[model samples]
Target: MSDIEIIKAKRAGFCFGVKRAVNITFKAAKKGKGVFTLGPLIHNPQVIEKLCKEGVCPTENTEDRNIQTLIIRTHGIPLELYQTFLKKDFKVIDATCPFVKKAQQYAKLLCDEGYQVIILGDEKHPEVKSLMSYAGKDAIILDSNQELQKIKNKKRVGVVVQTTQPTNLLQEFIGKLVSRVSELKVFNTICNSTALRLKETKEIARRVDLMIVAGGKNSANTTQLATLCNASSVKTYHIETSSEIKKEWIKDVARVGITAGASTPEWIISEIESRIRDIGGNGDNGYPHESGRN
Candidate 1:
């Protein structure tokens, strides 16, 4: 009998927003050629490759006059960049996630209300950059662990969080802001899907002998999942594809838990699971259990 048991997260694959963006891209591809996304539709390389095969490609700039249909990525683009695209002759298909769109709206509203806007997330991230555009020139980007002295002199502060940020960060950031600013307003822009995935992944990490997190390295949500797994004190491997799985990692492991990011596809997760089983001898494999979907 095989010693390894495999457990899978029920909600381990593509989240609603990602699924929507990908569907829209494929449908656009079928309609004609010269389809391009402002950036990657989603972070997963495999999915992007498939989209390319279907004639939909990703472009970083709008300078390419040949682009017939420009689809906005799931992360959305900066306000000025979006406006520039609208004026061009190319058809613009906005596939920005609804949750992200809400965050942008909130950022603009906060600025109009005369509060200092603070966005909680990585300053370099595409989504945060897009949020900053709506928040105006003076808006500040704050990391959860960073000092709040920048906003100390301001009487009023408004906050918006990245859609994939952990809930604890928001709670903690607000706790600190309450005392420093006389009036504080917050828009909880974090996605519900993100919260559920992190919660489920943490629980599984605690129970398993080893954790395997599958998704694109550049994907923020995927990286967060891997980080959470490591913090749980279980041996963890963050891999983009099944080929990354090594035989020795599972040789002696008794229980393996598998989870994926919002950008991951179901097929990739299945391949990873299959690889683990094959390496562990596939004979009398420990029964697999499924947690509820995200």
Candidate 2:
């Protein structure tokens, strides 16, 4: 067999939202005061650990009266929580990604205009829950096409999605609702960064012998990328760090592809590439410098 080669997605890792969130958190930490994120600033543990070293930490609840500065993550919190912080006089640094902010705005707008807002995402995800609060008590969360059947009246339905959700899932939910609803308005709120990553990952997966999805396990976008890759019927592995890589997995593979979620850092990707090269005896494959096209 020929020597192993590595192919990587150009758009993978640290999209605008994650970058902004990390930057804001680090800046706050630099002030050398107590800084608390309403949740983990982003999904990558390595990044979180780095932030912890800088004096930024995640609190389980947002009602931390002890912390003077509250940093919202890229996935914006519920409107009620934002109000609560304001009421408590906590100095708030909103690190919510612009893409997620847009989704919240669109959901709120639809609900205010008397349309029944339908969120297409995981009902329990922090971002989706936050968006639901913006949509008011009447909003519905549709996780699958079957859930759409339960929606009543179906007229004046407004559609929005979690930024990390696959575009096809959102489209499938909307397509199902369009037939049942008399009036449907879709905001297409899925982040372009996410869409691009998914597209590029899927493309790379098609040409590789195995796909390694690098990111924190808890990261929604990272898991979604792995799911997309596995759907291609290729061997796929999701790893949080380079140490997790197993030599046995790549024994027979001659070509491997690497991709990361929006929250993944460039260093982690580089580390994974290095490990793969050492184990598989392949050159760098000129990732990040290459066009990233398969």
Candidate 3:
């Protein structure tokens, strides 16, 4: 077999907000006073399972009001839910990413100023739901510009986007909105980490034979990474762990590129690179300690 080269993107794995949220959750678990989180602390299932082992339970039922502490996920919750939790006498820790908080702030601001708040994201996504709550129940969620047809006779529109969405999508959403609303106030809330990941994914994809996007299959950002890479017309695969790397995908491929979503863990990315290396080599049985990136 010809030697296969692997290029890992430098921006792969956990971003600042995810890192900060995970760090805080882990520390909360150490307190041992029945710590729990509103949801899987982040999108990575492996990390969530490990956190469970560390006594950080992910709870959606939340009937255990006696719980000592509750850590909010990286995506902030609605203001009413936060107040409700506080009223229930739980020691709520706001681990919401600062970027998400900023979006929520914009939503509230737009509502206060009487602009029809339109969020550029999936309506069901926690981040978008949180923003809409601040914008009032009637606030619109525009996952794509096509949704705009549902709105008629609107005088003013204000926009805020879920931070994980790609810049192109946001631009597309905004461009379509220009003809729909009389007054437009745009607060582009895409986080720095997301911008970097999207940019780096394309850069690595263009230079490699096959691109591996590592992160939770359920993660929107991870899916977007794969979509962005595929748009470059390179073969792309999205996997949550090393075990998902199929041999056929590597066969006859001389160069491999790897990039991951913001919520992905570095260890998982390393494992994936090792697996790719093993499959490409002739039972060499050894792999690089660290993946190469640019």
Best by lDDT: 1
**Per the 3 Å backbone cut-off, how many clashing residue pairs does candidate 3 have?**
0
Extract clashing residue pairs from model 3: none
Backbone clashes in model 2, listed as residue pairs:
none
What would the per-residue lDDT of candidate 1 be over residues 1-294, giving only the tens digit for each residue?
A: 454688899889899989999899999999998999887788899999999999988998778987999999888889998998899989999999999999999999999998889999988888999999999777999987467987744688899999988789989989988988888999999998988998999999999989999999988789999999999999999999999988778766778999999999999999998888777633433434223411
Pairs that collide, model 1: 11-293, 11-294
Q: Which segments of model 1 are wrong by more than 4 Å? A: 1-4, 281-294
Task: Give the winner by TM-score: 1 or 3.
Answer: 1
TM-score of candidate 3 on Cα atoms, chains taken together = 0.86
- Residue-level lDDT of model 3, residues 25-62, one tens digit each, is 88988877789998788888999999989988888866
For model 2, what is the alpha-carbon lDDT of residue 124? Answer: 84
lDDT of 3 at 112: 92
Worst 10 residues of 1 by lDDT: 285-294
lDDT of 2 at 254: 76
- List candidate 2 segments past 4 Å from native: 1-4, 61-66, 251-253, 282-294
